[model samples]
Target: MADEEYISVEEVASIMGLSVRQASRYAAKVRTERINQRVLFHRDDVMEQARLKGIEHEARERAATYQPKPTKTDLVPAGEMLEYIRERDRQLAEVQAQLNQALLEIGRLQGQLTDHQQIRQQLTDIQSERDELKQAMERARPWWRRILGHD
Candidate 1:
């Protein structure tokens, strides 16, 4: 409450509705003009100064509402975060390579399947031609001659 009392820079700023820099400036002025050295302000003098600046009541009201955002660095431990990112990248690269290889193998299998289908069609055609030739030979043979041909 007196000039000799010590208050933190943040406390002075909240009391004055000023930024820390502004509060510090006022503190400096008080030191030069009234107090001989840097020290806490008397409660009465701080109120009077706040009144003169038109921020005394407003500062006190806003002080309770102020909420600082948590810094990004604080949310995650630095070492663990770095390791997690590196591991994720490595896994992604490995998965990509495996996907590429799988696609290549699929293409190769498809080609072999096509070749096998063509071969099957050709074998079916050849069997049909052979059956037709055998039928024609049977029709051309005379029954008596066919019966005596073996002897």
Candidate 2:
């Protein structure tokens, strides 16, 4: 077989049917370190290690029973907390400003809609007044003339 190059921890896990953490531990046992936070393993080294560890039933059993411990870090200082709060407040203020602008635009549009409605109502009133004027003019005409005008 040809010499294989480097492979990622996830790739190794897929090949060995193991989890990424298990692959990481295997890589670490072989003194394989990550480069720039990217974990890579030599395929030959990984396969050799897997073959050697394959017959070790005790190691496999231990690995299956292993559990990672949780870590606790110190909380942020009061000053740092205040700074975070200030940053959050600034972001909220910016969002509120945008919301206010949107509301103002909505109000302007509503006013424009009201103006259009008022214009439409005025047009309807004008048409009614024109109709009434026509009716009044017809009524004021003499009855004999009105009868002849239609002919």
- The top-ranked prediction according to TM-score is 1
Candidate 2: segments with Cα more than 4 A from true spot: 1-60, 63-94
Task: Give the TM-score (vs. native) of candidate 1.
Answer: 0.48
lDDT of 1 by residue, 55-121 (tens): 7677656545655456688888999999999999999999999999999999999999999999999
Give each model a TM-score. 0.48, 0.42
Residue pairs in collision within model 2: none
In terms of lDDT, the poorest run of 10 residues in model 1 is: 30-39
RMSDs, each prediction? 10.9, 12.7
lDDT of 2 by residue, 1-151 (tens): 2223676676667556678887788766654546788867776676667678683454344435544333333366778889999999999999999999999999999999999999999999999999999999999988988999962
Q: Deviation in angstroms for 116 in model 2?
A: 2.3
In candidate 2, residue 80 scores what lDDT? Answer: 87
User: Could you say which candidate leads in lDDT?
Assistant: 2
